[model samples]
Target: MRTVRIENLPNRSQMHELYHGRGSLGANRMKKILVVRIGALGDAIHALPMVNELHRREPESEIYWAAGPSVVSFLKGHSALSGFITVNKGVKGLFNAAKLVRKKFDCAIDTQGLIKSAFIAASSSNMVIGRAWNSVREKPASFFYTEKVEPQKEHIIEQNLELLEPLFPNETKFEIKYDIPIHEHPEWKFLSETPILFNIGGGWWTKLWERENFVQLANRIDKVLGLPVGIVWGPGEEDNAKYIAAHSSAQLAPPTLFRDLAGIFSKARLLVSGETGPLHLAVAVGCRTIALLGPTAGTRNGPYGKEQITIEPQLPCRPCHSRTCADFRCMPMITPDRVFNEIANKLER
Candidate 1:
């Protein structure tokens, strides 16, 4: 007996070929598009290049972003974005966001790859584009997508751009760049003159380098480079920032928002930090970085710039991706001496 064979559906490129002009929903034809990449600061920053390219390619299309309350301020004033749909905390906020987005766009792209973000995309538009089941952070997130794209790139920024394959089917290359606006904070303007900076906090404990290491690094910079070092911190991190400055030549910087932080990154000669939002922000603004990666690998989440340096530990359990660890040895292994030499070499060059 002969058995009937079943085949899988066409991929993105094949679909494009079959539907190029006949009712194709490419970016060229879309009147409105929604990009759903809600918070965490670093992920939001990574989506910038994708948003910028969408605007660049389809200037007439109204590009909107659905962002979390914390990053709403950062996403605002983007030259490409038409407006924002802020997603506040709690169930009421989600319902309100869903209501506000209902039937509002021709397409919605869920770059966040979380279930909540995918739900936002599904509610916002008829055509939902998202990462494939295996590619997304949450497997369930892919279920809501009408078009599922599996990314071919390693970096988070490049992975985000891969979501646009449906929109720009003919294009293979994209400019992985960010045009982040820099509004110098009046109080933190002194940071522009500071040559070296250290971000003393990474939200996850596993991602944070030792405070004592920062102190040692700062003293080394002062002794050899003769360059002033400054400490940059966010909320709930002031005490640690002060501790580093008090023990060494580093000075504490004023509290500043993303725009102001961008201003500092635009001018600072170098920044030392573990994998965190600020580390990615520095890369976005073209600052040199010595990224101390422990629970995360440099190849995937590290700075995108070729000149940027990422120092990973030699430990076997280095990239455990753990939020909490019994013995967190990776960050400590990246010694102050290693970081200092990188900074000195880069400056000398």
Candidate 2:
């Protein structure tokens, strides 16, 4: 008896490869493509290049991006997407996705490699494209892909570009970088002559560098560097922002939405933050950034271009990828003085 692979989905595109040219009922008429990468603001932002590259190649092809409920507000009515499907983890979200199960998509790419993300891609089409065995975060997620590609890049954005290979033959130039937010945000302009923005949230406890360190850094930037510093906070980090500016020279940034946040990032003279989504957002908008990395490697997720500096601790278990640590020694390894020296040097240059 032969063993059938349970993880592998039935691939239909390969079967019609020879006959599906331009006039047949196979490849010619199939122009609609589904792009799936949802949640964790940074991951969703990283996948934007893939969508832009696809749209650049074929402007007429319809692209549907299945995203999480939290990030969908920014993605709705994006020029690169034909539509947005909101996919939650619960039964209601599953039923919402099932409505499109009968509608056929020519190809669907699962840029996010997870069982949950894989299930969303699998539900939309049989020709689900994903990462190869050795590269995916969850090994089983690769099994759900009808086509799996192994890439040799460490950066997340570069790894995502490899998934679009089967769609385009030969290496594409892949020049264009990030997509700008569609809405214009002139609401919050930088009032100071030289403004520095500090991002207060770093996802979880271990990723956070230290609230006191940020407070000290804010004071140093104002007093020593002669620049105005403002602190930006997300949903649950309001008190952290307040604590950082309590007795310091730091100015609390006005309450702003995600769109306005992009404008703030673009205007800042420098953005100082630990590993987090807004750090990546600041990097995306060409903001000069000083990234403090602890549990994660700067090589994999740090700022991409030359206008940034990333500082990582020399601890033994440096890139442990742990959310919680018993001792929490990594945060202390990076001090306000060390980060300030880098900022002072950049300002001098």
Candidate 3:
């Protein structure tokens, strides 16, 4: 993935034809709006609130989503969305790009401001809006968007909402909402009987805390609270999950689909996790959550629900945001005892 800066973006008028056409469609004109947010799992989840707002503003409009294959399951079966277009980030992605352009979307909103995402948005339609590419960590990608929407602040969810301001009269009045359906699974039925549920893996290894530490924390929680514990793992964390399950009193959850995971988190008395998609999903579904922050700052990516607690180590060198760690110091600084104490305190309240 090559990077492009926002200043170096191509002439904005390249998309003038498309934007004018779509804007002409106006409130009375039925238009197909394509929302593009092909990024990491957590970012994709954050972009959902914007999708919901778009639906509310245009009730009769057709709403489509372009996301990575990893997030397709999450977008599937969503009531606010009419359809989803998969953007496979491989050689096949070019073919997908061609297929996407054929949709003739009136508006293409790129929530992910990377070069690839900008290129997809640019190639898909004339009316393209996204973050200024130079604003991205990697520059040069900005040349693709027809319109650049700069956020007033750094909060990603708020930034996404800012992009839709042009489409609505009052953007702030709209509430942030994510509607992930509840899927019934036998595993969920069994775990529904259990009280506490812990999510054991993040999308990245650096974001994940020590597995043994989580095991110790779960065991201690089970012992102190007299509640049965369960651990949820995503696609590649089965081995880590099994390790935690083997070492702790917590039961291992079966591989869960996106909706099933949401359902399980919603029903759980508590959810303990790192900064991952499921952590946000837990918050979105209105679960009691305790999020452990490591490389990322909790302030930027913390859970945003009513009943949520974030536990981050107060070290000077913490929140380095490094993807690979030679020294896993920040996470190790957060001991199982500390997390357990917080859990007990929250439960007591």
Candidate 4:
């Protein structure tokens, strides 16, 4: 099916000039591309494969990314991106974003299926592309795409790649790689050896394994590997972090930026976390990750690629994808021995 280019958008002649005579970016006007995937770290990480796929297909496309303030900071100055536009979240944010994204583009794709994100892509260029009605999280958002796709794949990462098919139909099955630079952290001086980073999270409470279980796993790792393990935490979870640190042999790792987290992951012997942002980050940076999954679907959101392990609870109500569950035994069902055994198996390699 032919892509439906919107009215008043550039024609093939203008497009040729935009795409540098449908060639590389060296000559005259280089092709400009915009991508919209705003908010929350894990979803953004899942969208990275699409961005890398664009670079591989075009090789010279000037790719721009738009993300929310909290998430934008993580993606700023990323090597894969040509530039970044931070979408502020407030009454005047969209107005500000409309002005920021006014420039014309060769194509615009919104991997984020929210209407706001679709509007951002819509404002950027007329050639907006996104998921079809059935596949999109927000059904109304599909109206903005000039080309809406129905994904054939189940995994979100693969579904993200399917969105690119309208633009580059032939480029399929490329490796998912995040080429961002890992920053150095002097605060990690305590790790004289390859250390384990146990990232604790409070997001999606139903997905979290028991904190006491984490304490047990920490002690087990220390006993088995003779390595100093660290408990990583973010804002608003200080009390819980401290509790885990106090209850186990794991040290309280200093609070970290996304870059610092990248650094930490680069040197980490292994990383353990529930289905959250850091787990995705660990996978993005090629860190060995053990995902303790419960309410979330392990097959869809779990760590992809090698050097990864996922411990999923097989309860009947598990993988409900619900944010809250009163009697959520999915995580509680997981014993420290189960996780410790998985860690030991991963550590042995």
Top of the candidates by TM-score: 1
Per-residue C-alpha lDDT of model 2 across residues 1-349, encoded as one tens digit per residue:
1111122223585424622342233334446677777788788778878888888777876777887776787666566877777777786776666455434566778988888778778777767789998988889999888888898788888788888776664666785467657343554544345588889788877888778888888888778878888889888888889988896888888787765677788778889888888888888778899998888888888877777899998888878889988878887889999999999998889
In terms of lDDT, the poorest run of 10 residues in model 4 is 1-10
Q: Model 3 segments beyond 4 Å from truth?
A: 1-25, 187-189, 316-318
RMSD of 2: 5.9
TM-score of model 2 relative to the true fold?
A: 0.89
Per-residue alpha-carbon lDDT of candidate 3 for residues 236-307, written as tens digits (9 for 90 to 100) = 889988898888888888788765787788778888888888888888888888888888887768887546
Query: Considering only N, C-alpha and C atoms within 3 Å, which residue pairs clash in candidate 4?
Result: none
RMSD after CA superposition, every candidate: 7.7, 5.9, 5.5, 4.8
Candidate 4 regions exceeding 4 Å error are: 1-30
Off by over 4 Å in 2: 1-11, 14-30, 98-103, 182-192
Q: Best candidate, lDDT-wise? A: 1
lDDT of 4: 0.78
Q: lDDT (CA) for every model shown?
A: 0.83, 0.76, 0.74, 0.78
Collision pairs in model 3: 3-139, 4-139, 4-140, 4-141, 5-134, 5-139, 5-140, 6-134, 9-143, 133-142
Residues 84-180 of candidate 1: C-alpha lDDT, one tens digit per residue: 8889888888878878887667778999888888888988776789999999999999999988899899998999898888777778888876888
In model 1, pairs of residues that clash are none
**TM-score per model over all chains:** 0.91, 0.89, 0.87, 0.89
